[model samples]
Target: MPRNTLVNTGLNLLGLDYKPLTVTIAAMEADTHFGFEQVSPNEKEGRVMAVFSSVADKYDVMNDLMSGGMHRLWKFRMRQCSAVRQNHVVLDVAAGSGDIALGHLRKMGDTGRVILSDLNGPMLHEGARRMLDAGYLPGRADCIQADGSCLPFADAIMDCVSIAFGIRNFVAIEAGLAEFYRVLKPGGQFICLEFSRPVLPFLGVIYDTYSFHMIPQIGEWVTGDRDSYQYLVESIRRFPDQKRFSHLITQAGFDLVRHENMTGGIVALHRGYKL
Candidate 1:
């Protein structure tokens, strides 16, 4: 089948249209399965690339709306924690909108270099355009199409690797983590910013309600596409919990793995070192 056709089929299978009957059928089918096999890395990458490509123009706006501009504050905090400095070489995987890369440049000065990478061509194109509009020199930043699970850079080449709100979309989280470890210099840091379940039971229930109900409505009103937003919520729900994710990082060769929950665990930042 043609790629677009296949993507549409997959979306249908996921019941993105918010039809009550379709959702009921999908849930019944899923419950019947004993255990689900994880989607292949390539398949997952394709889904992510297609989704982001279709939504690239609205990506930043949706983020601002959904997070109420708190995403920026969270990213700023990540930069400060990263301790990026002059002459440091940085790799930003899935660097959507170039926000974190721009933040690093602002702090690290002209001597530092940042490579902003994403698997989706449209996202990279938009990111490059935004960088140029912001007066960033082409030499100071490199925007490329690359998969996080298989970074193209040489091993041990980067001082820092960061992914903000992007890690959970990886086709194979473990492979991506291992790639982060491989690309980092010894003692180099690996950092991820992603959504996490709220810890308090009451808060968790409230958050889930909002995510499942209100988020899709907002997505339909704002983006004219509710399916993508629904998928976003499902993917987050399916992602590993904080402790399991931290353990996966350690298994992938990161040491001293630790995570900090932010905004009542609505978002969390996980950090580790290559050493």
Candidate 2:
């Protein structure tokens, strides 16, 4: 039941070429989902970290190009739902490229603090660099390499926790939600902006075709990494719909859970309060 043997079995079944490697099956236990397939918990984390590391340099520009700037609007909408105030302490988990953190900093004025964290070191470094380049002083924001499921902060300390387009990548999303709930103070807000199932049937069909077919090509052109983009598309498809995701928020000790669909449900903004 070695990992390589399992992979080779699949290749043999599918009539595809197989390459040998040293990774063991003990590292993959079929206990978690990585993209659309089940993988070991440890394997999923390494794979996800590798994906972000591979794309860190070109992530921002490629995001603008791929989403046609709609990601900006989505982040803006997430910020609006945050209702952040001056002196608030916010945590932006999986804050790749610092979009949500930057938006929160602008609203927080001089006294607020935003911590940008990601599992991938390169992504966190890139986000911190972007914050510095934008004239945000070192005091206004801090960057840390951390996992969403196991946040390193104290309990009930953050005023707001926002994650944009990052939750679906979690190996154990419910664990992440629990961590978010634990780190947020009573009455604090949790906002998530992420890809979701499209409401319009026709649009969903077209979106699926374009995402599966064109996105990898775009990723190749932009970052020379098609497999990473392919994983992203598959992960989005495998994420729960809004209703189910709302249930998860409630299960994690959040109250007043609600979600707003945007761009015909191509993306959604989910908000909840720790009460």
Candidate 3:
């Protein structure tokens, strides 16, 4: 089917009556290929949350298998840079499966607190259940369902905000970053770990090939879902490069913005401060 027809069909299914002419035209242009137009930040986040929710049961397993257990190391490095303290309160946005929040708890002990928030209830439910199974009571780590672009927290309430492999999925990265700035205290830190374009030419080609082919196969084998993995690879390709994303962070009122390329830039850890 033509792109406009497909978009109209989707809108019809959603029961949206008014169609912006520009959006229809844009959809047609984007329909020259199989990929859809970039969704608004809110829509993007919602779509991703739904996708993760659908795959929640297999999410952590897929991550470990897909990344060869390197995702844990990357997350650990992000936590180290976080420099969390026992007296600090951290917010983990889009905290699927609660790996980062759990790690924070382990490092900060009972005196610290971490809130795991995600737009998807299923992902949050799984994370909450896992925390309970591990003997961490609900109060020790709170799980709230919320959109990252509009966090439900008081201004300057958190000492640190972190999102792992999550920000790229935000419908509006700028809006999400602004929300991060708003929720963090002065001198608070924001850290994000995401897939980035590899800087090394040969390595980049190799990584791209592997991600496009092997990752989806693993997804199909493990979760019986290859399309979601394909979407993941496409989203990474569509994401803004490291430097551009850093500029967005700065524009969102963060200071001292910097990013470190990891694994030859296949992934990057971005850190900025609310100053």
Judging by lDDT against the true structure, name the best candidate: 2
- If both were scored by TM-score, which would come out higher, candidate 2 or candidate 3? 2
RMSD of each: 10.3, 10.9, 9.0
User: Candidate 1, residues 114-190: lDDT per residue as tens digits?
Assistant: 87888777777787887788776466777756666656566777889999988888655777787789878898999
Residue-level lDDT for 151 in candidate 1? 61
Tens-digit lDDT string for candidate 2 (191-273): 99989999987999889998999989999998999999999999998999999999999999999999999999999999999
How well is each residue in 14-98 modelled by candidate 3, as lDDT tens digits? 1222233343233223212111445553355446766786789999889999999999889989888886889788889888889
Look at candidate 3 and tell me the lDDT of residue 147: 66
Q: Please report the TM-score between candidate 1 and the true structure.
A: 0.84
**Candidate 3 colliding pairs, count:** 2
Evaluated at residue 89, the lDDT of candidate 2 is: 85
Arranged by lDDT, best first: 2, 3, 1
Model 3: residues >4 Å from true position, as ranges?
1-46
Please give the RMSD of candidate 2 to the true structure.
10.9
lDDT of 1 at 156: 79
